[model samples]
Target: MQGWRSSMEDVHCTLLKLDDKAWSQWSYFSIFDGHNGLDTARKCAEDFHRYLLKSFNEMLKHGEPIDGPLKSSQLDLILFRKTIKQTYFFMDEQLRKSKTQHDESGAVVITCLIGPEVIYFMNVGDARAILVSKTGQVLLSTHDHKTSDPDEQHRIAEKGGSIWDNRVEGQLAMTRVLGDFSMDKDLVPPDADIKEYTIHDTNNPLGFIVLACDGIWDVMSNKECAKFIVERMSRTQDLCKICDEVLEECLKRGSADNMTIYIIKFL
Candidate 1:
């Protein structure tokens, strides 16, 4: 939802199946929260997945199973993580080389690659994601990359950057993001924070996962949003309506920015 924003700068991507062949069984979803303008986010929504698919397929050709917790040495797992990080950088580099001036703006991203037995989350800036258990317990949550984070502060400082008023150079709130070519590259990097979570549907079962922009996080705590959805799901099973209501709840609670949420259920 656009909420109170004068212009809607947010965009999203969802693919039930990433592609054919080995990728046919995988899924993808992501939120790109744009700042300054929508071009960066829109471009990411259209092209980011392609880079990911190409990278993953190349890894697959080498017999590195897409479904991992690879029993054969940990090289495969290490390579898997490396590939994810490289893809983010590659996307960023592509943007840096774009002929258009869209890179002047920026977009924070939270991307998920949902495989048969595991989920991979790659994020930058404040767009976040979380995976919940069957009983509504949050199994994992992404840490936002903002000025308030000491590590992020150090990262910027190491690059000769300064923070003023809790923003990078007092202009941007996030320490990392895609695009923003006008800023110091080391200060506002496009490096992604990647994570992995193994899915267990039998011994522990599964509940749902939530992915949203900082617009929602600005007013709602992780548990608050998760609890609201868990309780609401008991009363209704319509996921699409639930997503809309989640955005509405954020608006009513004083979120003034564009809001986007994705609720993926396993139970």
Candidate 2:
């Protein structure tokens, strides 16, 4: 949903399943909110997954199957956190080497690697995601990487950057992102923060997960959005209509930026 934005700069990715036998049970979904221009976001949407998958596969050793633990840890998810963080740098390097190397445009990312047993969120900038339990409760949510955040502010200052009007270096609203090659690498780092959650049992499975840009979040609280979707999903089970209603509600509440959302259902 492009809303009132002059041009659509947001892009989304949804892979119901990966192609490899070991990864066949896993899926991927993401939303990239582009800023300044679309080059960075478009490039990310095109080849980002390949970079991520390649990194993941490279990390896998001879004996570790898809669900197996890494060489360093007994837990499978411990390996994924490193993979997700490392992939962010790999992705930023790719953008730096691309034809649009000088493009100042960047994107905030909210991405998920949903596997058979767990879901991992790799996020940057203000884009966010939240998981809801089967009992209609918010389980966990990603933190927005904003310049006003105390830790983000300290990191910026340590790297010779300053915040003005709550914007990083008096420019970017978020402290971390991708494809902002013009910014100082140390200041506006391209790091994807990680969040992990194990899937619940049959008695209380996850109801859904919501991923969206600040357009939706600026106007709606986490609880508000989750409640809105749960109420409709229970009554109609129409994801499309539910999304449309969300957009309309955001628009009504004066969300001027482009709006997009993904509802990953578990039940």
Candidate 3:
């Protein structure tokens, strides 16, 4: 992690072993990028994982049966999506009601839940989650919620909000985020974009997954970051070192913001 601001406003969480037996072995990773202040990001880093685990446990206990003749992998994907969606909404609602002061700060979030059989991701605002396949392919990536996006612009207009110089109400550059009482609640949605992937080829395996805030992305593309990791993977499997190198590279490329990155590799 690197901070350009006087006080760093980005926070992250990595749980390599969320459950050893009950949930069939899973991991969790998240990135929270705060703008204006660190309060929102700090709050999420402290409580988001707990809420996610609670939702995961509930799903394990009373999961719905797979419809029709769907495969087990397909069923797992459906359930994971449902659980993550519930977790996001629940956390957002809780944040909203926790206290009126929370709205003064806001954050972008990207979280990943990796299970033995599948990988699930949830994104809100400009933070991203990217997957690189074993063959060095960009399998999946989350879209940034920028005010310049057509769909986002429409949503903002419908909610009586305006964009100036590609910023929401001439302030926030992102169209979706948590908190931010200064913006219209209807325009700045807390809903996240959730996706799931079934890991069928254990033999070949996936290359890695990268979860990061826009600070890093502003200086590098998904392909660039994945290739950097791939090159390093050929010589070493030290994920921590690789992340440090990436952060250094971003800084060298002139990223002037708080940076946070999380990497997960499949063996």
lDDT of each: 0.86, 0.84, 0.81
Q: Could you give me the TM-score of model 2 versus the true structure?
A: 0.93
Clashes per model (N, Cα, C within 3 A): 0, 0, 0
Off by over 4 Å in 2: 62-76, 201-204
Per-residue lDDT tens digits for candidate 3, residues 1-267, read: 655768788888888777554543567788999877777888888999888878866775565643332233544556767777777777777777774654588899998877667777889999998999876778889988998699999888888889998898898899888878677778888888987777886655688889999989999999999888898888888899999999999999999888888888877
lDDT string for model 1 (51-96, tens) is 9889977887787355633322323778788888888888888877
Worst 10 residues of 2 by lDDT: 66-75
**Colliding pairs, model 3:** none
TM-scores vs. true structure, each candidate: 0.93, 0.93, 0.88
**Which candidate number would show the highest lDDT if scored against the true structure?**
1
Name the candidate, 1 or 3, with the larger TM-score value: 1
**Model 3 weakest 10-residue run by lDDT:** 66-75
